[model samples]
Target chain A: MKSLIGWGVKPVDSHVNEKNDKAWTFKQKLFLGLTPGQYLGQALRNPFNWILGIIFAVGLPLIAYRYFFGLGAVTHASNDYPWGLFLGFGLFVMVPLSASGFMLGTTVEIFGRHDFEPIERLALLNGLLGYFFAVVYLLIDLGQPWRLPYPMFVSFGPAAVLFLVAWHVATYLSVQVAEVSVSFFEWIGWLGGKRFIRRIAIGLTVSGIILSTLHQGALGALFNYAPGKVHPLWYSPFQWIHFFCSSIPAGLCMVIVVSTIVKKTMAWRCDSNFSDNLDRCTLGLAKGASLALITYLVIKLIGIAHDNEWGYLATGWGAWFLLEMAVGVVLPIILFAYAIRHQVVKVARLGAMITVLGIALNRLNTALIAFNWQLYQEIPHIFEVIIAVTIFAIYIVVYRFILYRLPILYSWKAQPEEALAAEAVRPAPIRTTPSPAGAMYRKID
Target chain B: MSGISRRRFLAASVAGCAATTLAGPRKALASGTFSGYPDGMGVLVDLTRCVGCRSCEAACNKEQKLPAPDRPFDDMSVFDETFHDGKQKRRPDENAYTVVNRYNPEGGAPVYRKVQCNHCNEPACLSSCFVNAYTKTEEGAVVYNSKVCVGCRTCMVACPFHVPAYSYSSSLDPVIKKCIFCYDTRLKNGLPPACVDICPQEALTFGKRKDLIKIGHQRIETHPGRYVARLYGEKELGGTSWMYLAPVAFDQVGFDPTPGNEPIINNVKDFLGTVPMVLAIWPAMFTGFHLLAKKQKGHDDHEHDAEQQQGEDGGEQ
Candidate 1:
């Protein structure tokens, strides 16, 4: 792919071909301005695609097997442990990690921090895809995955915490689709939809904040029903706050982790605006994450103190809990502090990676490990693990597919007429900016 | 920014209103101390009188028309069948709605405990279900509507007694399987459940839940040292329909010792109460933040770039 780019291949970041000033057709756009052979060549050349192939070879069948033979075929399906890895990992773990959308939206839009604007669209796309795949994992895990709309249409259990989860996730998915579709509008040259979304951007952002808060906290509240089941060490009276607060860091750190990966792997796809601003944005996010991490750490201790389960700290489970905090919470806090102070983006990136893992660990502990602590631990079935990995692989594939084509990493350059319209409008679009980069792309005009 | 915030605030307020209307009435009905119904029936199982005969298990199997057991109802070897590496005893599942597990606490004789849904006054399954699949009936039988069940198995996660098992083996339509206290067949007609009816040793007593409370206390008061003084479900998780009297400690017979008196729903009410609060406060509050931010942006321009300021004002939010 890098060799192809060396041979003067241009990935589609706008509608026009710089060569003859001819409009790139939808086919050309889909292929990143490559011929079908070249598209296939680039895909096959990448070893990552081969790994995805190997996973899908085994995983797709297992997913079908689960559906055909029922969840019992691939899962332990034990009465003692109802929610296996599918939910423990898929729903509980994925949702918090995907919270980058609301966090960045609130920052760049509400707080008017346009310096973070370069990565805002990426954050939104991350949130959208993460949530979409979380639901995909859910559909695979559910007994009647097809009846997902039962809560909304057929029946209503509005009082249940899960009811809020279903409604908010569904509503928030639509909200995210609208939020991220601005990029698609630019990619497809649909100025009207872009303008319409721009008109209601504030409304959309405000709603995003509301839905994100309730659903993120509601996910934690679901565990409150099983007070006797989840271990006292992980369980808390203020489980919602613990979940909500921790997600602030979880979401921010996830953005850090994702942006770092994007920067390293796909630097060509990024504009100077993105690459130059990323480190600063990352450090800024790290600062926010450290603050949230401290709050989460303190509240976690407060939960323990309120419960008077400080005695559990000496026990093995307590050690495990402390390990989570030390690695996931406290270590990151210290690292972020030092990195921000020293302006070392690398250390902050490492902290972000660990924080991502820490959030995963914390959620996995609350939902799986520390759950049923009285009973013996139940390892997930091999097939269940395979299916989960498969879905996540698909998630990555879809994420890359968008990042390669859409203007998430690079600001899309509007045509002259569109630019005139953009100038007439105020503040321009979120990521789109007037720059020398756009001047370099104009062919004859 | 003000126009956008005002419109969004109105939209958010409507959403808040919708949340309230949707969650309010149902919660009001469920709120406060909801003890069982006035004429609710209950069962009192006296462990001191039980002989681990397995007759009640047989009666339950026959009554519910469950699949044929691997061992017949007469098999005593099933008592020793522990599962999940002996950490768990035989439990109610898709095949059987009730099971009797034999627990031999250290230095005590083997005590048999009938394991089934405790049918709490405020059932966790009832509260945890997003489909409203469970119901604590007027007769105190915590029944289920499998037709409405989406098979999320949240009920299984929420059931503290581990009674509501999923029919995971069925690919087409799996649902929660649990003892409904024979609500459909016998209890609706004012007849006792088959297990309670077929208790040859009279270990299971069936009557009004209120009367049964008195009877349970009387037995504990009258027969000194014969039974554990505490009634296992008189106030456990907001009073189960099936109360227990054990010869040994309740925990010795596989009961949770610290199943608090407050209903399981109480634990979640704190979070649930905040849903409306968050929905109401966040839009206006965050919009105010946005206005403040835009104000700062405007001051930076200082009337030099009026067009840019207007753009910032609209696009900032």
Candidate 2:
């Protein structure tokens, strides 16, 4: 891989490649010029990989068992609780966190906030992988995974909320793939692909925003089907609004959370532009999150009042609801506000973590814990938990693999002119000298 | 900068505003009402006359060709079954289309509520179904097409009565199992449902929904103290094909008394109303925000240019 980046090689323009030249075949792109040993070394060095290996070892068998024996093999399989952690964590929680792609695409491409350009690819990739993995989770949880597309083509359940979810998520996944493909173009030295996407970027971003708004809200609309099953505090007819509103903060904070983890765990993969601008980006994200959180908090209160569910607040479930609001929404709001004002990036990071937890809690409350409120609570079967974790680990591995290889955290080295232009745009600091080492560092950045 | 440009902008804005106002609320209003087909059929089950004999259960089992139960049809021991930490008494499932639950209320003879699909006049399962697998027949029973079912179980979620059950144990194909009011065997042919026909005690009444309501009222009026005043399904959850008359309170017999008079679909209308609005409005709104942000960026560029020029002058000084 290092030798492949040698100075004599001219970068391929994706637009030109698409028209005149053959693009890198899928096999060539997948290998990425790495020797098998380097790949294995990197894979084995991470402790996270060992954990993932253990999970896959345990969970793959259970997943097979579930298919062969039945859903009763790995799940509690109560007719009362048809959906469990699989749908709750996988579909509900994952989809909102994955909203990062459209949000960032709209910011940079449509809104032209180029300051956000550094993390834009990362967010798009996050969204694509999150959605892709969410579908994967659905496949595992579905009784008939093979018939997944039946709702789209075989049968038409146009009136059903799940029908909307199926169509939108499928469409949105394709949009996200197109959005994220620009990074793949750069990584494989294809500039024509990049330029063509850039030309249609505004249209794609706008469409992305529209699709994401409906589907994110649609996921919430799903819970409205079970008004009696979900606890009152979580169930609102305006659930779609609550879901859409909360997702704004959830998506922004997820970027903060993921970026924070990336910075800590894989700093070498990030360029200085990304590493240095991260704190400023964290503050910017915190400001956005605080505004969203306050709106969410107010509307949540309104939902309670609108339904006259204030009396339910005195009960244990209400206390649990309050706890979720306090820890997840309210506490994070205050923390983000204070953190942004004081320029406390660490506190903002902590607030982002809390907000992520809050989003998970809210989804779980709706989908599982408070589901069938009149019935006994169900803990996920051990095998079921392992399968969920294993799938998530696969998501993380794919996320890291893309981040490591793609131009997400670093500018693509396209033409020498664009490289020089990027250098000129950067605030000149201590490294203007033309020593051989300095030139190499400059090229690397 | 010119009057003509301003006039053109104003004209465009007016057109856009006109288009939005015309399209927005009209679409919302269209999705709100879900009045069932006027001539759709419905059934009325009178529970007060039920004697807990399990005759209807046997009849339904035979009519549906379901697998035999572990115990004999005459076994009373099945009624004592409890599940989910004793929070639930056994109701209907995939094999058992209808089950009689014994709810012992205070100061009342234990009520035997024969539970099955109420087959709503405006069925939530019908509206919530994306593939349109469910249909409300003019004969009044809600029937489903198993061929089209993907078994996503949205019908299970949409059913306010918790009537739809999936055969999760099946590996290859699973369909939502519920009482179709014996649509294929009897209801469609102008025959009373098998369970209704076989009931020795005349506990189960099968008639036009309107006529059944009148008969229930007449029965209540004839014997005031023998039954509760209100018909259980007359207006609950926007009315059901199977009506109930109980000597004890409805809640005592495992019925949810407070599922509002509005149909289950009504609860979802507010969200569905927003879908088209979002599809129409979000594009322009986000695009407008983009244009505003772009304009701000342009202003920032001009300020940076001014600052750059000032810095050069200071360097020369």
Error of 1 at B143 (Å): 0.8
TM-score values for chain B across all models: 0.91, 0.83
Model 1 bad stretches (over 4 Å): A418-434, A438-445, B2-5, B8-21, B24-29, B299-317
| Candidate 2, B1-317: lDDT as tens digits | 12332343334333323322333354354364544455545555666677788988899999999999888779988778888768889867888999887777897677788899998877888878767789888788899998877666777777888898888778777678899989998877888888888888788887777778888899899999988898988888878878888887788888887888888777777766776677667666866775676567766434323433443343345
Provide TM-scores for the models.
Answer: 0.95, 0.87
Q: What is the DockQ of each candidate?
A: 0.54, 0.34
Best of the candidates, DockQ: 1
- For each candidate, the alpha-carbon lDDT, in order, equals 0.85, 0.75
Global lDDT for candidate 1?
A: 0.85
Cα deviation of B235 in candidate 2 (Å)? 1.4
Q: Please tell me how candidate 2 rates in CAPRI terms.
A: acceptable
**Proportion of true contacts reproduced by candidate 2:** 0.48
Question: For residues A1-445, what per-residue lDDT tens digits would candidate 1 score against the true structure?
Answer: 7889899888877667878887789999999889999999989998989999999999999888888889888997588889989899999889999999999999977787767787889899989988998899899878888789999889888779898888889888988998999899878877657766655677788888888888889889988989888999889988888888888888889999999989888887998878888888899999999999999999998899999999999999989999998999999999999999999999999999999999999999988899899987889999989999999999999999999998888877665555546544543433343356522221100
Tell me the tens digit of each residue's lDDT in model 2 across A37-131: 65565567767789888888887887788788767678774567878888889999999888889888877765666677667777888889989
Q: What is the C-alpha RMSD of each candidate to the true structure, in Å?
A: 3.5, 7.3
